[model samples]
Target: MNASLLLLIVALLSGLAFWAGRSRSLVVAGVGGVRTLNSLPFYYGSLTAFWCALPSLVVIFLWSIFDGVFIEKLVHPLIAPAVLEAAHGNMDLVMNQVRNLAASHVSAASVDPSVVAAAERLNSLENINRWAQAGVALSFAVIGAIWIWLRINPQLKARAKVEDIFRWLLFSCALLAILTTIGILLSVLFESLRFFQRVPVTEFLFGLEWSPQTAIRADQQGSSGSFGAVPLFAGTLLIAGIALLVAVPTGLMVAIYLTEYASPRMRSLIKPVLEVLAGIPTVVYGFFAALTVAPLIRDLGLSLGLDQWLAISSESALAAGLVMGVMIIPFVSSLSDDVINAVPQSLRDGALGLGSTHSEVVKLVVIPAALPGIVGSILLAAARAIGETMIVVMAAGLAANLTANPFDSVTTVTVQIVTLLVGDQEFESAKTLAAFALGLVLFMVTLGLNYFALYIVRKYREQYE
Candidate 1:
């Protein structure tokens, strides 16, 4: 249903764009709305299409946001008071179960009569929502068709109208992307706000100790755990630094070999093989890290006279970092290759004409020209490293150690977030809410890096262009 709604929206938006383009043309032709509509027939057509689709979509979106809660509220009261009380405040679970029961090929055994009735009511509500959504979609389709028919006139300056509509539609689409990003940031900001309320924001932000081993039950020991994030942040930087150190030179070299020196046959063979690195799953890399790379690092470090006290476990940051670097090499290399290849052949010939070696031309001209894209690639790779969960969670240690040692065990922010919210916990609690704070921090860091990277790329782009 979600997929269908999105597709429907895209289709509707396309229709609106077409109509807007046509209508704008007519309006530009100096037709007045009061004087038989200033726009061409096509312009009128697009206007009709835009109004029919956009208004309905807005309504559908608004309705969807409130529909589930509204239905749940209606169904909750109908549920037996005894059942509701027995379930306590976990009405959401009960509701979900009821939904599952209704959808299930076979229902789970329910002891409460009210629960069963509620499940039935929930099914009824789902059907109603489905019908309502279907009706709205169909109505919009009909309205769009009618608008198209009415406005599609040969006399109508559709081209002008279409262009105008197109511009507005593009503007709207751009705004939508920005708004979506803002919405995400707002949601994270609000959750982080809630987290700050339960825990002092300063204590959470700047504390040196982190002990998130909170208890679920009141009687259980360690119910109140520390929220210091220093260790996780250190771990993240340490691992990311190691990964970049490994990946950058290696990936850049591969990109150079492919773009500058490799023979046609070799390029054909090697480029795909390198790109194939990206298709390999991070979990596969994790397995390689945990089972293969980690042990290798430990054995190598041990052989290099690192004593047992200088303990480098199989799950050291170096191990995870090395493997993660391997995983991200393609991201750096592929982007670098494309950008390098895009450099003007004339620049290469010009350098060669001056008796510069192939390597020199590449070093002096091609690389400088492609530096923006290369930086963008590195930034993207850094983003991947920062956001990576599976490899870090699997290969890296869960200990929130703040040590700078590459050989020592360390946990990343993603790993901590996963561990923090892994099981049943009240979303309202400090521990659970801490995940949001960590997430916000992670997001801000990544966003800042990306923004900086893009700024550099844009500056260089203007220089070269």
Candidate 2:
């Protein structure tokens, strides 16, 4: 059976088990009634459904994980040793060919006779494994349901057992999330370490040039590419600074207007419309930046004769930063709105009672009280702007120039990372591995921002409480 169909069947079985357990509990209650039971009928039903699903899901999960390795072992003997020798003893290549042949991705006539034979064997074994897995899972589900149904009684601690099971499941999910983050960090760290082995850490960090192009052949031009990242860092900061300039004051003003001045009806109408900006895809924003904003800026610059004093590129950081600011406006506004609203009404009233104007009350009482959260939101938005890729790619030209001029074309760390990892790349090469090094640095920067935000939030929260 296919996975989807098997999952549906298990769900139906669990539903049936729930019904059976509830009916059985009612029968057991008898003349004494449900009051005599240790737990409610719902708990019994839940316990039954939990047992019926958990074991079956575990079996499916484990089987899906190891079945490929098991099938590979079974198929290994079927491939001729001569074929392995011919492939320079590269097991992965042979396996790839085998998988392609088995999946009919490659024509059988194009494959060797021995590989063709192994493909057929692999196909057969996979079919058998799927059926076996389905059968075993169903058996476990049925057995678990039956065992729990038989043990159902007035004195059974069904609620406690179900709660304990759920507590552990929640803990497992939290642990899994933590482990996944650790796995990402470790993977990036290891790959970056390999990159640092080829290129010096000091050069990567401090060198002004940002070229990462290495020649594939020794005779090719640019054989020893520069890995200096300073230009990229400068470009990233310049663009991000421009974006913050556009976003911060505008978003905060909007939040204040909505929170302190607008009527309930106006707030209701404007808040949703403002938040819709957040839902628009970044690529759509990118298209707008490239085609509309960039040209408009270029034309305006030409008309105003600013080109005499400064250069205006068709694709400049200004266009990208402006559009990115618009994109993240809702992020800042929404969070600031929430924080501003969280300020104590009593505090505002106290300020007003002291003969302060509405604006004064807002500025002195509300904003100060919510300063920590507002700062946190701005930092979060800054992180969002820094890590943005699609908008930067389309609007900002991919030239890592270290300049503060927003009218000049520039690129960011994310843009460079995407450029470096665009196609089939050899992992052993410094050119490809540079993407991971950029990622590690980006990760650390964002991590620090988030940690600092949390620290500010805790410190301010204690004072307020």
Encode model 1's per-residue lDDT on 1-465: one tens digit a residue. 453765576476657656664555455446445245445455565555665666566667777788888888888787666665677867776776677667764455754666677778888887888777767765675566566555554455545755887898899999999999999889889999998987887888788788876777778776588888988899999999999998899999999999999999999999899899999999999999999888888889989988555867767998889999999999999999999999888888888999999889988888889999899899989988987888887788788888888888899899888888878887777788899899999998987997898888777662533
Name the candidate that leads on lDDT.
Answer: 2
**Backbone atom clashes (below 3 Å) for every candidate:** 22, 0
lDDT of 2 by residue, 229-253 (tens): 9988988988888889989999999
Alpha-carbon shift of residue 277 in model 1 (angstroms): 0.2
What are the lDDT scores of the predictions, listed in order? 0.80, 0.92
Q: What is the lDDT of residue 224 in candidate 2?
A: 77
Highest TM-score scorer: 2
Worst 10 residues of 2 by lDDT: 456-465
